[model samples]
Target: MKTAYEILDVSEQASDNEIKQAYLQKVKQYPPDHHHNLFQQIHGAYQTIKDQKSRLNYELFDYPEADFNILLDQALVSSEALTLSADSFDKLLRASIDDSIFQFSTTHKINNT
Candidate 1:
């Protein structure tokens, strides 16, 4: 479940040249003929950061931890206990847990490098 940045082995704030260099290095190691899956992932990651516009759009939508917390808190508060059955409540809880895990992973990835 690595982010594109992780796939490229580049920092979130990597410069264009740095990203290009990393992509090239990765391609050299995992050429498409022999490593099609890995090569595709590397290429996709490169495309994501290949231009300023695409990079800006990606960054703009990458939600912060606080935003996700706020959203989850709102969901809990907005839920009507009387309207949801036990099973529904369980499902909601599971979704909340999943969201939290996703948030944690994103945060971890950002902080790891």
Candidate 2:
């Protein structure tokens, strides 16, 4: 239930510059080279509230408590315990094929360039 402001140790009404300053301070304390886990958290928190537009969008989409609890419950379940349907399997296959094609095309384009 922690907001990006909480993660960055910034106030909810903090200006963009204030959020950036807090985020930079946190990142300096937990540099990616040393504290990768903490760095990712700080970086992600910064990304969530980096701009006024993003902050507004995030604040506007507040899920109800019940919905939030439902989402958390669903997230807690292990992916390994779930069974994939035939449609999902097909989608995965298509995605893999598309990824391969995209990679090949990009490589080819780079070589040509």
Candidate 3:
């Protein structure tokens, strides 16, 4: 899935005006009358991160789609020369899960406040 920034062809650091300009260009390239689906996507992306607050909200909540097979392959290749005991691997996985949960809770609390 393309991120709003990607769809708009704008950098993540783009200002509101820059994003608006990019959106206008995209609309011109894919006008609703001739390219309904592309126009809808562009419009949706624009709505998603058109302003500072909206961009922050989207960044806080948007989770990228992960390719598990690719991740697994990378992990296996990286660990090929080293062997992890069952207990060590289990500990590593548990630690990663714990870190992710902690981060989520922290972000949730900050957003709620």
Best by lDDT: 3
> How many clashing pairs does model 2 include?
0
Candidate 2 local lDDT, residue 49: 72
Where is model 3 more than 4 Å wrong at Cα?
63-113
Candidate 3 structure quality by residue, lDDT tens digits, 21-77: 999999999999999999999999999878654554465456344333443343444
Clashing pairs in 3: none
TM agreement with the true structure for every prediction:
0.53, 0.53, 0.56
Query: Cα lDDT of all candidates, in order?
Result: 0.68, 0.64, 0.71
Window of ten residues with lowest summed lDDT in model 3: 66-75
| Backbone clashes under 3 angstroms, per model | 0, 0, 0
Model 1: residue 108 alpha-carbon error in angstroms = 32
Model 3 has how many clashing residue pairs? 0
